[model samples]
Target chain A: EYPHVLLAHGGGGRLMHQLIDAIASTFASAELARRHDGAALRIGDMRLAFTTDAFVVQPLFFPGGDIGKLAVCGTVNDLAMCGARPLYLSVSFILEEGLSMETLGRVVASMQAAAHEAGVEIVTGDTKVVDRGKGDGIFISTAGIGVIEHDRPIGPEAVRPGDAVLLSGDIGRHGIAIMAVREGLAFETEITSDCAPLAAPVLKLLEAGVAVHCLRDLTRGGLAAALVEIAQTAGLHIQLDEAAIPVRPEVQSACELLGIDPLYVANEGRFVAFVPEAEAERALSILQTEPVSADARVIGHVTADGPAGLVTLRTAIGTTRVLDLLSGEQLPRIC
Target chain B: EYPHVLLAHGGGGRLMHQLIDAIASTFASAELARRHDGAALRIGDMRLAFTTDAFVVQPLFFPGGDIGKLAVCGTVNDLAMCGARPLYLSVSFILEEGLSMETLGRVVASMQAAAHEAGVEIVTGDTKVVDRGKGDGIFISTAGIGVIEHDRPIGPEAVRPGDAVLLSGDIGRHGIAIMAVREGLAFETEITSDCAPLAAPVLKLLEAGVAVHCLRDLTRGGLAAALVEIAQTAGLHIQLDEAAIPVRPEVQSACELLGIDPLYVANEGRFVAFVPEAEAERALSILQTEPVSADARVIGHVTADGPAGLVTLRTAIGTTRVLDLLSGEQLPRIC
Candidate 1:
């Protein structure tokens, strides 16, 4: 009975799921109904991954990256999560009138650099301008198409009870970096955004013959959101060791000062990979070869035989607490 | 020498061209620097076309169609213009926080119907909500991927001096329709938008063996914009017969009342196709068989052998005038 869209509906949590479900119910195909990071399609014996993301972060420029880099990396990572080799991207820019041409040049340059580093091409693009008051400076929407070379069935459904959940690098840095700049909150140490492309590392793991079941990038609602979504979609229980999850000290202090949980803070360059318990070490080793994922480690494991849809964290104080989707609005438009 | 973006920069005219050129010049690949309707890519022996467009039309709902319908048809038309069979699309919605759920539902339902008619699947999508005052009601961006079944190399470069220019249907209805609602100008007769899926009729022509050298949809700057862009890109001269171009009486009246030329007005379902003079009759016959293109006619021809990069229109009074890109913005966000 929601009459107006709440900011929480776009927070990548329970309300977002409900909104998607409501909209997708009208689509005729079952593929549209499935909630996957990206859609996989078969074209003349070739498997392709298609994904789209809109970047509307308030401050166009952040500590480490800008909207352009995030626009490319976000869609590229979504395709990577589908076990695809990211190849081509189409970028569309919606700019407000009176935006500086110099600013546009810097953003586009950042996109080119990011695309080059990820080994993907910026093939086609579109541009539109809105009146100054009607829009934030600029919003970028990128749609990516990739070739799926890995034969593994990658999705939430592939996750099993004995799968070990591995995370690539640290979390919470991106959200904190943006928040500090937006709110003018100063910390003892400067915090930088961890916004780097992870396609190379992901493809490396798949090429090395790791049987990865599912992969989800920690964005929007962050690590907790990703885990909760996976648990719900796979109908399984996920148990996490809170001490193992990496959070930078500066980011931790910033989140504490803002009264926000580090686990719910966004990260642009981090992802969670669910691999079979036996191959977890091999996957971690391959991921560690890439600087972007050098801190890869197993942080949790699937721990149920039936449909439980539960996620719990084992805290440092020797107590268990349930982790669910953040129900209220938090850090809107973080990504 | 441009320092800030202007509304004219998004007017699908000279300023817009300069903006794209400035941004694309930094790309490492030449493919990105070239401005085409879509980028053609070869993937392991299969040829595909990828293109994206963002719809920011005001008044969300119009006379004949809504924003959702435009979101689907616009991308489908872009692929068809590349001589590709429209196959799949990824839709992304940027909604304002206060947008009504009922409105969103109707828009999505319209998109579903449009996608169904175009024989394209809404495979993947992303949605983000902005704070209430920061955004217009809704903005939809769609990216489409299609397979190239036609063996002919279709582009402005393929246009020859002896090629005939054919328009699929009437023009100016879409723009006038939106203007009618926004400006509250009422005519004696109602003007409905010609927004429709052009893929079926386009594919029929290709299947019937008509050798189309170039195709461009009449959007934004409308027929004049599409023709001017092609002429400049191909370095050729284009000649048009104003009397032969189809414009409904009501649309003509509306355009006159608004002091706008129908040729420079936007259209959603109309496209201009170029084919050799020898095959023009057969192509027209095949196109006319489809209800969507029943009024198809040859409106002009590629005239000068030299690359003049000029377009001339022969008025009904036997006077000729130069047709140039609209210098200033006429209608903003009319797409």
Candidate 2:
């Protein structure tokens, strides 16, 4: 259902709501539809978590979702990554002048749909029309606030040397799909962008009481960047098994053809979880059963050895190499 | 002080707390220092107002303020314009790599100073570091949510014929200051950008129970665009005297040299308020007493007879010319 994103999907009214419900809801859950300007939740001892993110993904629409859905999911996931329960969101837009009203309506419908699926509300927003040549078709900035329950405190500081890294599903789908369309690279099989919201899986883990240390969405710079952040934040080293990582054949082929590294690619729907080694299998099984994480796997483990803040990958042939944070934008404006 | 933005300011830790206590609090109230992810105020019936904005001003640091200071004020002003008492703000930053730590600390300090000045707190934030070329230097996005009191909605929907327009202060300082800095036009006298937060003055008038119909921050596109929005929104024509609008001598000379219409210029700290004709004097008197609005004046009046959605300016030549919203940005990255 996704291809060229229409501007209407970014509008704050009814149509945007429909888009989230119909498309993005497939990957999200309830608690996002309240549409409050800020998520009003009760956290013990009066602590709340609020976060904001701006998504200016080029082409607006892609194989799986559009920017409107991505905007909502991005901020919600960011809050979830910080171990916060997702709540309310504020969506703001900068629309290029002359963008079709119908298109704008469609985008807004998608956003509203996404928010409803996530159980959040679009309580307040701002819309400004820019000159046609000044900006891309549209740029959407979403800011969300959530409440972090006192009992569920999780962060990079919670990481331990014996922690196991669990990744939800395949990597590089979002980036490869975007590249396929951008470079006009035809494939024997088409790969869709994995751009779904992931607030529920996190809450499920929190509810499971699985002693999860940290959670982060594997988006821009993909697994490599996400891993680097955890490593640096926790002052630890990580070793990932390349064979255990899931990558669809189409995405792998597309990256190979374009000389793109799959580890550095992007995936909107996937997340990396750092958990105690004892709960690794339980967490993997839980992720596997979820529709969004049918291909979830245990990719790595945090180790006390070697250079701190270094991320290494073990290849299929048993050779290990460093996976570094990308120094430059491999695909500009991809997100 | 001017420098590149940094990661710690968004960390919600000591640096973030310190930032608020610095520049952002220069014009703030005690209630703003709570620094929760979001502010929860008990307004009548629990009504709330939420707003977010991004400041992408060039040079980062300007004559009077930096992007950080501007971000806090622009968003606070938006909440005030909506007739809400601003409470909390979340600052998100897209920082380009290679930004020095020194520059970032300065911006954070300025943000702290400005947030304090505006009567708000930088409660939560997200920071993303892009590759060196992805952004100019650092782009800050601030999202604020406010709680509005009951019986205080001031919108274009409330504007009626015979309503009077009040100019909060001198118009062209912010616009002219930025222009001169951008064009490298030196002046015999230095003109500082009027980049101050204005919630104090607004709350003063609100408490006075003035019959204000609408309010707008004359930022981008200046007085002309703000009036045009009122005219279009209310479907009424507005007439004003050319001599009534205040402009500094340096601003006049800069506008003349650049051939840029001063009307289309941006002002970061000024606002235009539409009030009942009878209460106009009281409003002006209140405005004049505030430091931010020392030159406040009754600039024009709403008209029942004229082209709907049009604004006319009576020039020094004793003739009227229509003022329209300039389609193009008068000054790019002016904030």
Candidate 3:
């Protein structure tokens, strides 16, 4: 552990994992022990998923989404990953003094629009302001409550060997989008973030009876981090086909130009689902019907042949390499 | 209405009220329209209360409580105000890069202790780190969900004429304690913050069949703001006896020295309960049984006469004066 908190501690990588583990160990509870994107608890006869996320993305706004939209969508997606229908959200803001009211209005409006799109209501909230330099422009923390309609316990524990791994869409765009704007990188075709709510598609899959064993959204640490976490938690091995994973050309180029791996780049709207191999085609088709996941495809499958808690990636050049968690963040504050 | 967001907008005074109203109008929902400290929600046959609060109190460590304890107790108290037994909380942290790891550990330990004392589980959480100088040492945002066992429909709308207003304990200690530490004020006897979880006392009142009509914690804008907001919402006038309201001598002296009103000072643990006039003594006794509310007393009563949405205070010298919300915050970031 580092003696002082560093930006990497929140990068959703290995450092972030260590930090969360330390915190989780201190606040150990049955629900928190699950270590999923959200905590699923049974309240009487109803099962609810509760989750929280704090957005400290710099610039506040990027090409496709602003901090407001990201805040809402991020929490909603966490609930969605738990196979829950997000119903209500509590939004809290820590605003810096001297921030433009116009900017605040725009962010609030963006939040409203995002909430409406995600079919979730912003029910409760709190606002606190800090001195000008003590805070960035704004930081939005959102907590979401959602209802799990199905009986399937969707999490890493439910993951089984031979389960098909499906990627919802292209990755790396969101990170590239944020990095391009933050680093003043100009590209012929601007790469907008693929930041969209995933509840609709997830609900359709569940409603259509897709036996989703596990679901994880690719966020701060992108596809690699999500896969590594699931593998470690499930005590299983996952094999990924790099050729099958979708990545936009512009985003790939952006990653290459910045000496970053596309697999390590973040994605706000992308998620991977694990289902029985027999149901992979049906799940893919159901996901493809939704515009957000139109690029959905089967990327790989779980296997028991390797050591547990290992993830291997088959490169495009017919080489297999172990995919490991990055120690630090390639781009900080790219939320 | 200001072009830029001033600290007053988050001060929990008139400006904060206006800012909240504007934001609320944009994110209008049935739960939000109620405007209670927490939103009471119905999920299937179960009724739940959900609320969020962000703690940006400077000088993270105060005389009696730290920001970590304050964060947990604040959200728990909000749910208590909704007449709910807080069950779970989601803790999110926005950390500034380069903050000492020891400080983070101490804060987390405090949060765990506070959560344990409040009888709530920290189920889920998120952490984000910003660059040094971009944020204060740390800002904690907590969202809590609690179960509402009773069907009393407690809120301002449930208040009736001739309702007795009860104060749990001394006011102004929390705010003054923070101010003393932040401003380096030397008081002979230190004023420790009255920051503790109020759920136990409130639950006791409800269980004892006190016919509680409304409950509200005195936080940022303190007793004055809570009373005014409740009065305006219930469309009734309230009259308070100044001599009956409890205020510690040290707290009063500090407020006087700082030229701040005790009525407008924040208290983290204290709350006001509105019950039927006939049950005033019973409710006070029930509250006093608990150590947190040992100083419970009748401070005022709701009246239908005179003007609606007015709060009048009767001084010890037989003079009545109107208590209104402060236009700006006397102390910002005091929460």
Candidate 4:
């Protein structure tokens, strides 16, 4: 009866239910049609893991990925990094009116590809079309659930004072690539965004029986922010040798010229693993053995002292400086 | 060391993990910090129900709610409508470079209040700041994990032909309220958005032994869309007496003036309950007995053959016509 949607649809009224029944049940299975927040899934003896994320990245489409890929990857990896095997994802779209169906199609296709690549399923979704100018072209919210082994316990709190930090490949490449494209910076070599599925590699590591204190994918705020968080959480001071941190020449040059620090730059397709001192070398060996992780190295060590556990970088000249959580945007950095 | 976030933070990268951990560990407990996706919590023997949603509503601040309230309630309702008792929520925020901290504080406070009102706790979160011009003010994403009764099997498929459709109350107030304010439409009586949490009322009906076939919140597309969806999903026809559909007088007038149908308007605080005809009066009584559901009524009945699952509305003239989902945004009609 509505010629235009009244505010009541969002009011959780009869209309909202109808819209959900039509859109969600049309594609989802009878199970999803039950209209529960999550489908009650039974997966072997493994522990069930769940996650959700919202995508509001403007310009929806960037060089390497768009909101679609980010939505899928963000949820899938959230599960995967937590020692879970991703199984399904539920996607919801808030589309502004007048958006081209073609764009939506492409975005959905990209999501499909990301899900397929991660060996997950997009089982349910909702589409809400807003008035033109009422919203941007699109906003996506994705929720993911997975199955994890009960034996695998991964997180920052697991890190001991003597644990060594192992990095998967180089840092700042993804951050710099985005910056280059976003800021229109010139580079001697063109850098590409490092956006990819890490479920496979992470699964491989889990299978190897390596004891990992934590496994976190460094995406935003880079390695520096991650280290600081881990240090503060675990109550241990983290010291990293600047020279030990790996950064590609192109990324480094861009950072130097832009007056941005590579440590705080964002990176996709990379991860940080905190391992015990005794197991650090083995972890590095296992990581470097994989082609996806060619530049793996032990970049820092956790200590028990200094300001109740902070992350600091030791310069080549032997001076130390605090590495703090960035409170602002690292614009001109997302190439 | 994130100098600026690239698309990779949304990627499953080092940046993404740090970004998540930075916020997660900031206020999380030791146990929660260890869980990959906002604490794989164990509360007694109840299996968990997980849900995720992203809020991209235009005008982050609206009549009765803001993006923050919607973010919290959207996920909370998703869990509640599933008949789950919501426990914890995970929040993610994507902020534009220039967004003031004051606005963010207001949003956070609103979310905190909503969470408190729903009796759920905010456990973990993620934050990312995009460059200026690349984003609007702010976008918030929330994911919730709740617990539901093991035997609460609710869904469209559970619906049978002879079921009664019970609406919690009213229609189209939310959409119209947003529209009116956005368009500067003057009215004798100002309409506010109906964005209240429905968990309490739903729990009340369940407690009264309503034995509902399914329960769904009518959002986005309003009553027409919600009913049509239910009809199609349950594979049954629906017949509604237009006069029985309860719309506020002002809302009805507004719909008529705007060439809009209240049935197609969106509602945020209402829901549809498909129950056995025997339980119809009881459900209505139980609903109407509550302060939140005082307007609960039986607007329609599920049928077997005629129209084969189409929704037909009987008008005041004693004639019936099909009701369809609203195609897109009717922006001018919001409150």
Candidate 5:
């Protein structure tokens, strides 16, 4: 109704999807519509995965990581979700005029450490500056390229009715961590962001020949949003067991205090992997062995064909509720 | 001496170079120090070129194109300069809250048109929105990937002592066009920005088997910046013939009025190619045949080795002067 963009348009929820659709309508391509973590293409007999992300998290520095770490890991994980081994990253920074050199150095160091940990090189970058107040302190945008090593196609469209849904680790920590700092909450125990890179675990699945039908990182709109999107894309009902989903005690307590659902909060390092029922156990074991995903658990399964695109959560209290995409911006600039 | 970054840190001048060096020291990849338009890498059996640019051009709607057009073409041309056939681009947008949907739609339309003309696909993208006062109307950052089809390594390092420098077209048009609108200057005819994609002409040169040693697109900081950077990188001296460098009469008049050197003004559609002296005439002919480069001319030639990396201009009146990198910001957010 406003005919202008709102903060919700960047919320990674229903409105963001609609904006993408509107823009994609002007430049329609199947690759763009696939809505995978990245675009997979075959060029000159080589398979490549490409992805881009812009990070504008408020308060620049946070509990576990800063924008620089988020920028590299986000793009690297996107490529890994496509069954690609991230190789190179191109980082571009937009800095406000008066940003401190020391702050910039710290962020750059974080990026270097993240890239090194992910086994990817920061090969090229660009920098642009705007006058103070015209921009936030700094905004980092990264684009990543990786080689597709697995032969099987990976995405939501690959999700079948018989697939199992597995969660890499606990959710809602990242969102709560940011909110706590932004609102100046004093909790007994700090809820640090779980914002480590997920490429290693993802690559292990592909290397071990696990049939990962689809892999999506639980990011801006978190578990509910990711499940709902996959359900819509694959036209299958996603059934989640609320009792089995893992949530750290601090995160749950914070969510309760904040009147927000853990299922709808953003997470940085967590991912939901869809795999054939036959190999879900192997995938779980492999994921659990990874440092960043030690709490991996099977919390859901694809149940039936759903032209209606439904996601239902079976609460621990024996009540069933439908989970939909977050309607509006619950947390702006979370990532 | 300042503890914080100034606008000049992003001006594509000496300060920007120093900032890049400091950032590169953290990451520490030789490719980052090469400072070419893009970084070419070898992964498995495939050769790839990757690059990124953040477009913060003031007045998103310009004389010949908008930020969308620049976003696509700028990244594409960066890859093309590496002798790569540009294949795909990833675009990320940071939109200020309250940006009109109509404006976004127009920008998307321009991006689609430009991508089609350049024979590249916009395969993936990300969008994030910030508060209205915290951001400009819209800022676009694009990362491009292309396949290296040419066997010869192309970059500043490839420039040789006997290589001739060729200008793709007349200089100063793009920069002057922006300045005219920003400063409210009037001319006999409005100077349209020569902000077209340079990939076609560059690809043509590669496909025609031209022995191009190095190629660099003249973007921000213009021809002088490009040449000086190359000279310093290659540790060679470059001599330019002022009379041979093409500049439109109106552009000349505007530069004189503003007391700005045309050599240092930006040009989005122009490039400087270093090629063996024997093929300079052939290269000129091929470049001139392209509509975007019809005014191509042999402007100068590379001279002997020098640790000092000198660039001398032979004036029309037979006077010679050294050209150095612009020490401070002349125009910020030009691209």
Candidate 6:
């Protein structure tokens, strides 16, 4: 057992998963047990999705988005991943005593704009200030509630054999962008974070009656962690074509230079959707209608002819390698 | 406008109110404009109440309660003040790196026990860890969703002239208890925080058909801040009998020693119910049924004769004084 919480415990890898499991086991609710991006609930004939996230990014402001924008979009995308139309959000801010009002105003303004873009209302909130040294500039915790319009159960539990895994867009830009700014690395081309709301495209896919089995966002541990988690939870094997996964040239170069794998880097606005092979083309078309998912591609498929919970990737060089969760975090506080 | 956010901005006084107003104006939602403890929402034939709070109590653990218990009880009570039955909660944690796993385990256990006592389920959660010096040991933010069963329009706006204000139990213990622990003050009798879930007593009042106009919990800035905010929101006058306001001898002594007024000190398990003068006795009896509020008493009444947005208190020496929100915080991180 771990004696203390290391930075890796919140790094969105194996350690983070273990920490989450330990805390979740104590509560022991069925909704929590499902372990989806959010908890789906039924209250008086209404189906709602509830989720919460804490954003503790170090720099506060990054290449493409600030912490406020990231906070709103992160929770909104989690609800959207549950195939729910995002509705209301509650934001609670823990600010350090010495934070400038101008900085706070800028963050609040960014949040308002992001909420407007996502069509969600900021309904209620709270604020607490810690002493100057006790807290960073600001840490925002947002909990969102959304309504699920479709009747399908959307989560890892619904994944089945012979399902296609479609990625929404390119990966690794978000983590690289933050790292570049933090480390003062001047890349030939600026790598901006791909942080945007995915609710519109997700809702569009649902409106077109796409048979979506599951959806998972590539957040902290990126594409690999999401796939590994889904494979384990569904007790299925996943096969991926490495060439089909999109990583921007700048991001790929930065990863190579820093000895980081693009597959395990974090993304703010990318997700993978599981659907039947027959509906893959239609789902991709629908997702492409939105700018956020214009680069959507089918990267993998689920299968039952292998060991359960195994994920194998076929490299461009025609070599197969198993993908597993990293014991330590590649990046800390990317979100 | 302030140049930087001060500790007083989160002290639940005038500065806090101003900061909240500024943020709320940017969101511009009617539910948020009400400035209630929680926002009451209507979703598909369901009347829901949503609220969020962040707990940054120093020392982690204090007499009679800890941050974990406070986090659960605070959100639950916010929902209860909305006249709703809290059904589900979303908890998010921000941990500082290097915190002992044992401390986290203890906090999680306390949260579970408190949730069980409050009859609410922790349906969803998230966690993030900051560098050791960037954050306090732990900060917990909880957002609760509760269902309102009654149809009465309850809030400061519903408060009317001739309404009676009934307080639940004594005040000043919670803030004093934390101060005692932090300052290493040893009193003749230990002063423990009155931090407890108030949903049971609140639900009892509603179930008993009490004509409750409004409910306000005595939290951060204590009774004075709650009264002033209510008076200003209702645009009415409130008169209180200071002698009738219960303050235990130990808490009173501690407050005096610290040069703090008991009326401005915070309480965790206390609240005030605004009802018609005719139903005051019945409401008191109903509140007394629950052990959390056994010391319920009628302490004040609403009036229209004085200046609008005014709160007056009658002292034991037959002198009247006006209660106003403090310009600065008396105690930072008391809750």
lDDT values, one for every candidate: 0.90, 0.71, 0.94, 0.67, 0.91, 0.94
Tell me how far the alpha carbon of residue A289 in candidate 4 is from the true structure, in angstroms, after superposition: 4.9
Provide the DockQ value for model 2: 0.09
After the best TM-score superposition of candidate 5, give how far the Cα of residue A74 lies from its true spot, in angstroms.
0.6
Q: For model 4, how many clashes?
A: 80
lDDT per residue as tens, model 3, A238-322:
9999999988888888888999999989999999999999999999999999999999999999998877999999999999999
**Model 2, chain A: how large is the TM-score?**
0.85
Tell me the tens digit of each residue's lDDT in model 4 across B1-335: 54432333322223334444443332233422322112222333445555565565667787788878887887777676666667666666656556665676677778878888888766444444444554556666677776665465666667888898898888888877777767677778888778877778777777766787777777656777667766776778999988887888888888888887777777777788888999999888888877768898998898886778699999989998998654343442221
Question: In candidate 2, what are the lDDT values of residues A1-335, reduced to their tens digit?
Answer: 32322233322222334433432222121223321122333322345556677676767888888888888888888777766777667666655545654565567778877877888765555444444444455567788766566565466777899899999988998888888788788888888888887878877787778898888888766888778767876889999999999888888888888898888888888999999999999988877767887777888899998679889999999998997755444665566
**Residue B218 in model 3: lDDT:** 94
Q: Per-residue CA lDDT of candidate 4, range A1-335, in tens? A: 44332222222223434433443432334333333222333323335556565565545676678778888887777777677778766666655555665676677778877877789865444444444554466677777766765475577667788888888878887667666666788787887766666677677667787777787777666787667767766778888888898888988899999898888777667888877899888777777767767678888888887665688889878999998766444643231
Model 4's DockQ? 0.06
Ten residues in sequence with the least summed lDDT for candidate 2 chain A: A27-36
Residue B84, model 5, lDDT = 92
Q: Cα miss at B222, model 2 (Å)?
A: 2.3
Q: What is the TM-score of each candidate against the true structure?
A: 0.98, 0.70, 0.99, 0.78, 0.99, 0.99
The weakest ten consecutive residues by lDDT in model 4 chain B span B31-40
Model 3 agreement with the true structure over B78-151: per-residue lDDT tens digits: 99999999999999999999999999999999999999999999999999999999998999999999999999
Task: Compose the digit string of candidate 6's lDDT tens values, residues B152-226.
Answer: 888999999999999999999999999999899999999999999999989998999998999989999999999
- Give each prediction's DockQ, rounded to 2 decimals: 0.82, 0.09, 0.91, 0.06, 0.87, 0.90
Q: Model 3, stretches more than 4 Å misplaced?
A: none
Find the 10 residues in a row with the least total lDDT in model 3 chain B: B28-37
The ten-residue window of minimal lDDT in model 6 chain A covers A326-335
Ranking by DockQ: 3, 6, 5, 1, 2, 4
CAPRI verdict (incorrect, acceptable, medium, high) for model 5: high
